[model samples]
Target: MTNLPKIGKPATNALNTINITTLEQVAQLDEHNLAKLHGMGPKAIGILKEALLEQGLSFSQLDEDLKNVKFTVLGDLKCDNAPKRRIIRDIVIASIVGDEKCLTEWLTDDLV
Candidate 1:
C-alpha cells in the first residue's frame, strides 16, 4: 500500500497541538478534539478518516473475545503412498492442457 503524504507544517502543528502524530493517533481522535485543532475542521477530518479506511488497517484495539482460527482441508479420497514424481508430471501435463477438473482432482488428493 502507498504511504500517506507527510503531514505538512500546518497539519503537523495542528496535530501536535491536539497530540496526534501517526495515522493511529489520528484514528483515535474524537470530533471534539479534532475541531479544536487549527486547520483541521470537519472536511479535513473526513478526508483523513477516508484515507485510513482505504488502507484496511485500523487503530482500534482488537477484541480478546474473538475466537481462535483453525484450518482444515475437505473433500477427497487419496492414495496413502502416491509417487511425488508422477504427480508432478501429471500436474505439468494437466496445466499445459488447461484441464481444470484433472488439475483440481490431482491437487485435492493428499500429497505423499
Candidate 2:
C-alpha cells in the first residue's frame, strides 16, 4: 500500500477483508463501497483519499471535478503574478505533452 499514513489496524483489517491490501486496489475503490465496508469510516476514507491523491489517483465520482480543474493551474501559471518563469515553462511543456499521468500529478501541484 506504499506506506499509507494514518491507516489504523481496524481499517487495515477491513481493507484486507475485502482483498484491498494494495494502493492500486484502493485507487480503484468507489467511495460509497468503501464507506460500506465494516470498520471503515469517514476518517479512513479521507486517509485513503489523501493516499490515493498522492499517487494522482481519485475516486471515480471525482472524475468530473478533476477534469474541470485540469487546466486551471495552467491558466494561473500564465498570469503575470505567477511564480518563476522556469517552473511555469516546465509545467507548460508538460501540459503540451498531454500525458495523463503527468497532468494528473502536476496540474494539482503544490510546493514540492
Candidate 3:
C-alpha cells in the first residue's frame, strides 16, 4: 500500500513527475522544493504536512549543500553482522555531516 496521502490530482501528479510516490520519499523533500512544483499550492502542502505529522514524520531539513547528496553501495553487502551494521550507520551519519575522516576510518586494510 502506498503511504502517499490523498493530495489533489494535480498535486499528486506534480509529485509523481519527480518520482515521489511514497510518504518516505516525500519526507526527503523540503517545503521550498515542493512549493516550487507547478501543482503544489499552499493547500496541498498543508495537507501533506498534516499527513506527515500524523505518521510521526516531517519533510527533510536539508540545507543547500546536503539537499542533493546521494549515497550508494555498488556491490552486494558482504556481511550482516552487528559491527558492520554499526559501521555502515556511522558512515552515513559522517557523510551527512561532511566528516571525511570518519568515512575513511571504516576503509581499513581488513575491510573486504
Candidate 4:
C-alpha cells in the first residue's frame, strides 16, 4: 500500500480501518462515500483530492466520465492540445509495445 497524504491520525485511521492505504484505493471512492467515513473531514478530503490529481488520477465518477469520451488517432498523429496529445501518444505507444501493465493501470477492463 502506498502512503497516503498526511491527513492526520484520525482521518488516516478512518481510511486504514477500511483498508484504503493507497491513493489508487482512495480514487475508487466518490466524494460522497468518502465524506461518510467517520473522522474524514472536508479538509482531509481536499488534501486527498490534490494528492490524487498529482498522480493523474481522480474519483471513480470522473474516471467514468472520461471513459465516455471516444478517442481516435489521426493519420498525422498530431494534436493541438499538448496534454491530451501526450496522453493519446502514450496510449498508442503502450498498445504498440504491448505494455499490458501500463494499459491495465490506465484503462478499465472493458476499455482494455
Point to the candidate with the largest lDDT.
3
Clash number for each model:
0, 0, 0, 0
Candidate 2 vs. true structure, TM-score: 0.50
| Reference-based lDDT, residue 44, model 1 | 62
- Each model's lDDT comes to 0.56, 0.68, 0.77, 0.75
Which lDDT tens digits does candidate 3 get at residues 11-109?
999888777788887887888768878889999999999988888889888588755666422222344567867678778778778888987788678
12-36 per-residue lDDT for model 4 (tens digits): 9988877778999898777766776
Weakest 10 consecutive residues of candidate 1 by summed lDDT: 67-76
lDDT of 2 by residue, 3-112 (tens): 55668888988888766677777776667657767788899899889888988888657344344333422122334664567556666666656666756665674746
Off by over 4 Å in 4: 62-112
Candidate 3 yields a Cα-based lDDT of 0.77
Ranked candidates, highest TM-score first: 3, 4, 2, 1
Model 2: lDDT of residue 19: 65
Q: Across residues 10-109, which tens digit of lDDT does each residue of candidate 1 receive?
A: 7667776545556765655554445556676566666666777877644344234321212111111243365775676667657755789979988875
Instruction: Give the winner by TM-score.
Output: 3
How far in Å is the alpha carbon of 35 misplaced in model 1? 1.5
Itemize residue pairs with steric clashes in candidate 4: none
Ranking by lDDT: 3, 4, 2, 1
